[model samples]
Target: MTLTHFTFCSAFILGLMGLTFHRTHLLSALLCLEGTMLSLYLASSLWSSSFVLSTTSITPMLILTFSACEAGTGLSLMVATARTYGNDKLHNLNLLQC
Candidate 1:
């Protein structure tokens, strides 16, 4: 397959898998969110690589940085929640009546 076709196929698969996996625990959902972000970054990079210069590089770097921070914060929060509540299921969050 060509570059464009490969990009499209991979983006589609990653997006689909991300959506599908987002309904699980906090870590899985966070990972899925990251996967979706990666898909968007890859598609944008591949599509614009033919015309633009490195103007797009800054955005991807920022996105990567933000995603890393987000994942770290999420993991920390998950650890705290699990330590307090004994589990990390999304539904378990609703058990917090306070």
Candidate 2:
């Protein structure tokens, strides 16, 4: 009923949708990762506001920074895989079959 709960639910739904609809492993992974980051941000912000007296603002900033790094790394890997395989489908990545 609270904003935090709503945010978490929304993030969870988005993750589920991403998993169910995305055929490409890379895109699905990115969507899941983004959903996770969004949930974390919302939770952190909620807690920070509720416990403003004791909470540090830097926590959310650190989480954002890590999320950015994760996104960058994931995108780079996706691009590399697409370039090498010419497609981003999960089942098509058979580099080890050779």
Candidate 3:
């Protein structure tokens, strides 16, 4: 297809791979989320170029805002987890068990 389609597809594939293979890495999850966001952004930008008052505009903006908020929260959680366990590994978050 077009470059836009290729970008979206690549981003989607990367996100899926990161999610599947790096479940224990918060950084990987963040990267996957970013990839998903980028794909959505690219799709929206492309769609908006062809239609009037496209829903894609608002959708991408909302997604970006949510992604920013999610990143902040995820970073905070990672920091807290790291401090408590001296590492950022997902398996190290066993403090809840105690």
The candidate that wins on TM-score is: 3
Give the alpha carbon lDDT tens digit for every residue of 10-93 in model 3. 888888888778988677777787888777776876677677775556776777788788889989998988787787777765
- Sort every candidate by TM-score, greatest first: 3, 2, 1
lDDT of 1 by residue, 9-78 (tens): 7876876786676666887877777776777667666656665777765776777788788889989989
lDDT (CA) per prediction: 0.75, 0.79, 0.78
TM-score for each prediction?
A: 0.69, 0.73, 0.80
Give stretches of model 3 more than 4 Å off: 94-98
Clashing pairs in 3: none
Query: How accurate locally is residue 65 in candidate 1, as Cα lDDT from 0 to 100?
Result: 80
Measured by TM-score, how close is model 2 to the native structure?
0.73
* Whole-model lDDT, model 3: 0.78
What's every prediction's RMSD, in angstroms?
3.2, 2.7, 2.3
